[model samples]
Target: MAAVELTVFQVILLFWSLRTAVSQVEMRCPSSCGNICIPYPFGMEEGSYLDERFKILCNSSSGVPKLTVDGTKLEVRDISVRRSTIGVMFPVVSANCGGKDRNTVVDLEGSPFVFSSENYFIARGCGNLALMNQNQSTIGVCVSICDKNRDSMMASCSGTDCCQTTIPSFLKVFNVTMKGLDDGKGSSGEKQCRYAYLVAQSWINYGSYYSDVGGDSDPYDMRHRDSVPVVLDWGIDERVFESLVKNGSFHNSSYSSTCQFLNPSINSTNQSSTVQCSCRPGFEGNPYRYGICEAGRAYDNYRRKIKAKMAGIGVGVGFGALFLLIGLWWLYKVFKRKRSEKLKKKYFKRNGGLLLQEQLSSGEVSVEKIKMFPSKELDKATDHYNVNRTLGQGGQGTVYKGMLADGKIVAVKKSKVIDEGNLRQFINEVVLLSQINHRNVVKLLGCCLETELPLLVYEFIPNGTLYQFLHDPNEEFPLTWEMRLRIAAEVAGALFYLHSAASLPIFHRDIKSTNILLDEKYRAKVADFGTSRSVSIDQTHVTTQVQGTFGYLDPEYFQSSQFTDKSDVYSFGVVLVELLTGQKAISFKRSEEQGRSLATYFIMAMESNCLFDILDPQVVKQGEREDVLMVASLARSCLRLNGKERPTMKEVTMVLERIKKSENLTVQQESEYDRKEVMGAPWDVTSASTISSFDIGAPSSLDEKPLLHTY
Candidate 1:
């Protein structure tokens, strides 16, 4: 019957389609996985390609498939069958600069094996500041620093935890030098060591090359040193590449539909760079995966299942049949999602995120205490971190309060600037902060980096700043004497931990009253670590660009372009002066004698035995004259002219703790203290100029809304 003939015809069509799908020509991979095919010029070796230009090699030591450049095992995070070539992450380079005392050099040689011009180059860190020579020439370079550490934000690089800069386009290989500006974080080791290196942009996730590389990271067991991963781009000539992908390969059932090759030019040329390809609609696989069309996109267990369904439907419905159209649509979507996820995984690994996790655990850190949030989750939590939701802001970024899925409250600090240089520094801060578990320091709960600007999630502190109480008269308050002393003692203890107890040494270069945060219970929480510098005990401070808040910055360190633990001491001394007099650090007001320098003023007051004359009346009323005098003496000592003469944070902490204990005992004896009744004079804050004399332009106020959406 006619119906029987129709079924037979359908069978014939189905057979033809299957034949077309399987009859694909053998296309080589860029390289090989064992004996398996690695199509075209990207062969296992030179002979595998038309010329040596596209040569590739395998590394058996990888245990699984891996690609290498010249013999260096280039960690192939992924190979896109859709987009030819692969993503090979390189090790990151960190620079440690001594002050401008000498012209020391740290050579970076990625010589013969050139990075791809099509992709990007990234650099990161403070201390390791330099200008890079891309393609053997000065393309561009950046210098980053953080003035204060211990605040959740505020560092030399930005007001945030880290800073970043992007590499120039078309860079093949690069070099670094300390020519343009000098790094002074290496204040102590000014003679011998300084750091600099060229890194692939991919290696630095954010806040990458932190100075605290010694006992806090992967190379901790060894002597003090820090290394990070970097990424680079690669490509073959565009024309040949196009032919390889768009030749009589996939979808060209007939030779007529295949592309025609162009005649070679009448010149000596390998013609490798100018190649690309084409494909038909509803198709998304390499044109030369098998050197021709193949049955599936990327082959894996999951894809096999989808292919099986496709094949089964092909077997039953035949070609040109809409009978299984609905199933096809859904399958396509699933396939696309899987492909995207695979790419993300590839980027994640290439970014060394996986390695970081491994290292954190090996270092005996409780990795579970830290969480990695998906980019989208954070976007929603803060209204995509809307400007309206931002409660405060600073140099590197902005802060918005967010609620996580676990019902945890957090303050999300988001950066406005994102580039290659600070990318790694950002990642480094995240890793370092995640490992630290301090009660007095604001906790770094988690982070999200997939977004353009980085976002750090911290336990939110609702009480605002110790500055607000000392200065702002919002009727919301003036801190009580007990509250002030407790805050000072707690902050001192935290600083002590940063100096000696923590695994690595952290220097808070820009310490000030505003940077000190208070919790709802009035407990002190030392916030911001952006301008902080970490140094190994063996190494001196790294030379860095002059960076820090104007009034709170160390005068000796700034002039000398050097940094030290004592640098933090000098800055903290300025903070003490604020507490004693309720005065700003660098006010343009008051008599010259009172305003010459807070340090000078305090010293003069102490030497003249006029300490009581300058003490905040509220402070004097709240404590006995002897107790007030005792605290004032300590403050004066903290403001010593010589950094070496200033007390160590540990010693400072002991002194303050003794004072706190004595004050608390007195409160207990009196048993009639009322926190709500008495208060100090309204704080005479010497509001710092928003623009430091060194900065290019005025940065946005930390309290105003951001120019862009917080999201």
Candidate 2:
């Protein structure tokens, strides 16, 4: 029995299928362009079509008849009906010859026309192997032997720089991959690069088989020389050209253009058994005749003269209409601009810009140190805040790059969606950020309120967020041991400043690496205070609704609504694990044993004494495995589910500083002593003697692993 399907979903799908079918409809061709009479079975678009199968695209981007088929352009010079071929200029390969230093690349991401079984492949090179495939299925492989360009090269396909092989007939979708073969051993010289192309029949001279040059090489040089073009046999419904000599007619409008079947003589190999009907030359409306080919002036110019004159009068009226349209368009643009200005003014007032200005005048909202950028200024800086400017994206909003009037660069954050609920919070964040002055925090420069949504401006940090630098593949910056320690220290200090040094004790509820911005020199700056709360000086903890990034959220706070300074420490601990392992805090790629969060993995690794295994090789290269281990251990201590078990941000900062100083002292002592002297030169994971061991089987020093606990 079958499952019952939803009626509404089926109806929607049926409607969509019908729409797609109607859009793909085509007609036969008298597709005319530049005195070239195009025949039936060729199409341009919906209105002017020959047939779907033979569609020709006239790209007018450069104001010339540059042609394309399916989106890939082929320098199509001519198409001969009798010859059944398209003359195209396939690009030639150029070799860069440099001794011992070489790089060869071939990109065929987009192209049309498949390698047929009738097509042949020839190669010339030593230490080279050629491979060709289609749709992940291998067709053939060829290996060549020859190192340097010899003075007298052989003209035979005899295991040397030359070899030839043919492909299966009428095959579509081809991909070529090549490598160098060094004797049977592997690669050497300029011959290491293998070059191949489908050669045009004209380029293949009688005596030019596998030789680098032609016999009668004149001043014209005989050919361009690099890529030798091969001819591909093309047909509608046949592999062999002779098979197209059909017995009957085909109604091509029903499917993707029909012709004779895959045969030498027409006895249709097609599903319906071959019947072909091609439109006659010079007279093409449609094979279906029902297929629409809108009337063009050149077809019946004698009768069209009067219609053409009236068309010219209509064209003049059209120009007047176009002129009226242009005038209306200009007027519409002016109206749009006025409407936008009014909206901006409305938003400016609504966003408390007037109140901000009043505060600025009264010395409440300081404008001297902060900025008030015009919306236009930011739009030009970020190319209207294009998708490319996006630094990171999430459920909240997107951050962009912007430049201020004073020549300072800033990060402009635009909300994903704006409404009344958070509008006051947005303004408050900016106002609070503007008042803050701290070296360890990402500084708020200014903001733009006269836009659809509020735009937050902050000091630009070029090194990106610590999260991306630690884990994103696209980001090449791997967190080195020293850099990691320094970043951790800086982040701790920043949090300490936010918690105490600020006018109010601010809880940066989200303190993950993703929220920590880095400057050019890897200077850490704490950011993303969207979930932060301001509490009184005497308060040790604040009661609030739980909210933060998953993987780094304080477990205690998540379970209970109470958040504290230790909550920030726990979140920062997740950042520390990221720095050590060079993996995402919440990575999907992990063994089932190692939980999703980096903190969980780090704790597991620390417990198992396999923390070194999870660390980045770049950090391992830093020769401070002991110091790295200590930091990982500290990070482990911070991630303890119980808030009481986690270190204070102040202690975290102090311990990190002590670790750096101790490493420096150890290095100095090793330099002062002989090879055999001193406790150890530096920590090295590879040098087993210097590696530190952590106990895995023992119970955690913390009381217990609580199911959930906040600060």
Q: What is the C-alpha RMSD of each candidate to the true structure, in Å?
A: 31.2, 21.1
1-711 per-residue lDDT for model 2 (tens digits): 011125334544655554444344323325554434455444456645333445666654542233454454554455544344555444433233223222222222222233334345554455556666655667667666774554333334545665556655544434565666656444353454455544453445354443544553321122335433434334443322222223213333423222444332212122222223333432323332332222222234333454466467556765447667557767887999999999999988777677666655785444455577889999987878965577766555889876656777778888655566765556657666776688878888778888877787878999887777765644454566777788888888888777768777778888887788889888998887766776778877878767888998988888887888878888888888788778888877887677877777776666565767878887778847557656765676677676766656666776677677777565434222122211223222222111012222223323334334433
- My TM-score estimates for the predictions, one after another, are 0.45, 0.51
Error of 1 at 667 (Å): 13
Evaluated against the true structure, the overall lDDT of model 2 is: 0.59
Best by lDDT: 2
What does candidate 1's lDDT look like per residue over 1-711, in tens digits?
Answer: 344347556765655554455334224334556554555535565466544544555667653444544444554544544444355544434333323232222222222123443333332333334566643556665554433353432222231213345655434444556422234454432222334444434333234534334334321111132333344433334454455458532333422122333232212223222333333432433554333433433233344465576678669875456635656656877899898677666655544456566767686443556677787788788876765587787887899988878877889988766555655555666666765667888899887654556678899999888787777634556666666677777888888888777777777666888888889898888777776777776754656778888777776677777777767877887887788778777766767867556677776666655676877767878866545655565565566555544566776776676667666465334222221211222111232221111121322331233222211
**In candidate 1, which residue ranges exceed 4 Å CA deviation?**
1-369, 474-476, 591-593, 607-610, 664-711
lDDT of each: 0.56, 0.59
Candidate topping TM-score: 2
